[model samples]
Target: MSKAKPLSDAQPTQRKGAPLPTDPGQTGYGAPPPAPLPGAPSTPLTGTRQRGGARPVGWNSPSSRRPPQFTDTTPAAPVRRLPQPVLVSAAVVGVVALIGAAILGYRAMDTFDTVANPLANPSAKQTEVPLAPPRPTVTVTATPVPDAVRVKQNGLYKAGKVAAVNCTAPAVKPSTEAAALRFYQAILPCLNRAWAPLVRKAGYEFRPPKVVLWAKGQTSCTGEPTDVAFYCGDAETITMRGDQDSKLFRQDATSGRIHAMDTLAHEYGHHVQMLTNILISSSSRKGWAKTEPAKLEESRRLELQASCLGAAFLGANKTALGITGQRLETWEWQTKHSGDEYNPKKVRDHGSRKNNWLWSGASFKTTNPASCNTFTAPAAKVS
Candidate 1:
């Protein structure tokens, strides 16, 4: 150009009016220049802004990259829990204990019988041997005595009939008389039957004794207000003051028909003695009014034997009279009357309670009069 300017001077000296073009490739001293930004088009190098700019690598550019920015808030940490190893170990121990308990439970069912052969160890076995094919227990119930059966055995005689007495004229019973009359009536057939055999076999005259039921503290068999109710051999009649017959009737009736039957049967027993003429004391031919101890003792024997006779009568007729309502009444009466004999302290002695019970039980077991004979029994064994 203008006289082909000298190489150095023509390139740089007079360039104040215009800007020089950049030699991007050679500007970095052999390092390659950076490429243009992604959206920029290819063009001459000059002072141009980049689309989304990156800084130039020069003294003015920052040397260190900025650190990443952070917010002030922090996230919460998770809660800690029991260690898995400890939990697993405890679960394993529980399973082992459960299995052990199950094993022990199975063993306890056989009564804890560890012995293999129970028969081989006699000492170890229980004394009560367990029965094979166990049998049902059989319970025996006593049958009840019946009135018809009593009639067949001892006749119509009531056990305590000798204890009655008449108080008023005509010796009739008061309105309370129904029970006593019925009682006597009930005993008639039974006494007739009982004494018939004895009278025919022994050749003894049979005469039923009269019964007098009157109130106590009124005129009575002894002619005074005595509580005594007894058979009067002198009058050939039984006198029962109101205190006794009324009480008996009320008690027997309230106790029920069956109990009344027993009481009637007991009274009738005295009639049996009278017909047999056995009631009069051998020591006192006149009667029981004598003060002799022997006479009193004889009275007691008669009373007791009559009680046994009553039981015998019941046992013999258990199937006939149908002692149903108060089935146990006869048994109770027999047991009660047994003790009326030989008691010195008692106003009227028949027998001891033990004797009453014994003779009654004996008579039922053995109908023979000999079984009821207490006179021959040892003093200690009699009752």
Candidate 2:
């Protein structure tokens, strides 16, 4: 033991599996390595030793020991702590929020559509709903019309030219009565049809009048004597004696004779008078009732007007009623004869022969009722 002389005096040397010591002023192969720690200065140099110096043992600290080599088993780095439950909860919460938002959005859309556009929801509107208010009811009444003459009892009559005959004994017969009655009913419609437009134009609704006939030597139920055909303005009725047929031997040509047709036509004209308010208004005028000279002329003019209106009714529809020109000639003759009932010059004279012929001719030529106005026409023209 060379008396390990004095251990302190001698320099230490590295041993196997041991780390070399470091000096402050001395350097190793490159820069001087770090000083070994007090503990484990060379704890395990079993793997590999530094080529030039002693080594430390810790892996993170700077060590002189060779880096530990592993067969890919060492963890590459400290694993990041992953809170799986917390992450899963956060993801689920986000998805739940999105679903909630989607639900809320759909509900908002539905509410907007319903409130904004009601008509777009036909199905919803179709459902029964309360009404705002109820409806009201109303009623109406009608007026009664007058009755016309029965065609069975009284025969039809027309306006026509004929010679006065004795209808008293020989002419009285049931066949003639039946024939006259048939003729009246058939011809009255014709007269109405012809005058319908005139009356309507004059602001009236034309209605046919009643017709009644009495046989020869018979008194009317009202005690009137058998006489010529007459229109009752009061009852709006017509009364004709059977004996008058002898006096006026006129009748329908095709159906019976020209006389009966003319009689009914005249009576229908009277009915037109009533419908138009002409008879009442004209006859009741202030100056009309007075018995003055001019007033008498006015009466004649009034009657003449009635005559003209009658003629117009018959002649307006000549072609449609199967009236030939020859029949028109017969009409002129009839109007002249029948118009004599009123004296044209007297206060009551409707018209004279000249006036009757002219009025009838004017009606035959023109369908216009305005043209038949006898009031404003020249006296000469009226005649």
Candidate 3:
């Protein structure tokens, strides 16, 4: 059988600072137009007069009446000029009146909306509404519902793209078992909604994995529940040990809510693996997983993929889930603590903190699962 090739190594850098964690055999990883200026009321041409005409400063009262065709001895009446003090006062009054008229004209101009006034620009044509440019006519060529053969070869990559989800982040207070259980249960539907449709489209029978919210004392496919959280591929169940989980998933932000999401979603990521047959296919692979380095490599790919898938969901639904950039940045930085380096025995079962975040950052930047194809990436990148 053809195993997935090592994918491209185009991962982004993990931002430093808030949330990552551990679990037994499984359950691990976590990771928002300028109006055009209308022609200025043509600046109302300074010299041009407006309508409401009183006729241009008429010189001819009755047309050519002219000074009665004469020059005039009437100059005697005109020679009686006003007294100097009165003339001065009248001059001052005229000045004040001119200033008042200027002020009023300015005020009227200030309130006038030249664009709205049609007469403002008689040359202007009707705007014609531009018909919205026909919305660019989206000729959606459906990606041909990838066949089973395509799904087998491409795996999750065949699922194509997804839009961000409308998932409300459940208010969770860590260290409280009930809240932890509720938190896990709350996001299950969202996780289901994210992966189910894609599975069905892939020509695979889709069944959501079981989620045991308070399975601290319960049994999982792995037998006794020793881990804080795990996904039992054998039974298709996602079981959580609430009490121990509260203590372990103790990420302080949102009362440790984000930390819980990372852990739960990481496990859910495993569920995606099972649904896509990647986990099953991995188990049956030869030489690659048999050697120690190869084993860790495979493990990292798997775990990191979980990180990516889980983050993809969170990223998709971040707005509705109240996940802020600050929160995610903090989470990326803290992911370093979850690396195999932190393990007491120094076993690299999960992956390097950098790789954990590398995959996560890649997937979080988009709602697409195909980007999480760590199986096709080079070993150095995953390391």
Candidate 4:
């Protein structure tokens, strides 16, 4: 027709619901074109025509083909990628923060322990860490000494009326070591009788101290040579160098008996300190002192109190021991001489000669232990 159009130039008739041919060279009219085979090259589009009136948006014309529509129900595989350097830096920062937090927590706990138990180990080595100042030790009920003894160091306690002592003096003077030993042994019974009731009245535990008259030996308490008379609270023993003490007593003609009696009484005063817990309290104070000067002052208080107690005992039984006015004067003089003035370096620990005389004289005029509270006395009085 119309001179019969050539087949190559003929227009193809389309069927309903059939896909249109995309290539000019393709022959399909009604059926869909064959799908691309696996690994086969894609056929190029030769026309701008689609089933619609115009090409769809995002579709290129002619040689460029529209991408195949995917109808697969399975999800695509996620792309695998290395983490960014910035993200890696963030992870490293998080780990460092955790480590720093742990170290700070540990240090905070250690500081708390040190502050809570200041007395647990005071000699511990110091560190650069900032810490709170040490606080004063609280007086607890668990302490070895009685509350009265701890608080009354500066006051008086009425030890009650001491009865007259029934003691007969030994005939032999302390001229020889053996004679001195016998003389001290004889005097022990009188001392026990004089001090026992007073200690009992004060509601304290009491036992007669053991006496050791050694010529040349070391004491168990200090492991030091027994060159002078001393009372050891650790052993509850009174040790006297019999050879040396005998010579000391005999050297002074005017007050040989007074010197010997005072020496023995002074050592016995230490026994009273141990019984009443004075020694325990004093040792704690001295050990806790933060300065050398404070420590020395504590020592002076202890020694001066002991001297006062010794005079208390002597005054309570002065008539029984036949201590006349001249003997008393000699005793006072000897007490003054026994002060720290004899040794320049030891002055701070034993008080001045005037302080020793005042304390001893005060006790000699009173029967009350309350007057012997040297701890509460003014610094000038102690000095």
Off by over 4 Å in 1: 1-175, 215-229, 240-259, 282-297, 324-326, 333-348, 381-383
Q: On residues 212-322, what C-alpha lDDT tens digit does candidate 4 reach at each position? A: 776444544657543356778877888765665566557754466666676677778778878877777888888888999888888787778777777877887887776
Ranking by TM-score: 4, 3, 2, 1
Model 3, 1-383: lDDT tens per residue?
A: 00111111111000784444333443433210123245444243443444442232222221111111122223323346789999999999999999999999999999988778869844556687754555566787876433323323654676766455577767655567877778778888888887888777755778887766644355555465343466778888776656644654464444256666766777887887787777766554423446787776766777777778878887788888777877766556555445655554466667777787678878877778888877778888778
lDDT of 1 by residue, 56-130 (tens): 444333322322223323443556788999999999999999999988998766555547656755345565977
lDDT of 2 by residue, 1-383 (tens): 00000112210000365665555654443333555454544454444433344455442344345433333343345558769998999999999999999999999886776546768654455548786676676676666321222111111112221111211111222245555555455555566555665556545675667666655565543465533455656677655443334333433332223444445555565565566665555455415445564555554555555555555555555555445566656655655554433422222345556676676567556533443455556656533
- Give candidate 2 misplaced runs (Cα > 4 Å): 1-175, 214-226, 246-256, 286-288, 292-295, 320-322, 336-348, 378-383
Each model's lDDT comes to 0.47, 0.48, 0.63, 0.66
Q: What is the lDDT, from 0 to 100, of the residue 368 in candidate 4?
A: 55
Give the better candidate number (1 or 3) by TM-score. 3
lDDT score, candidate 3, position 272: 74
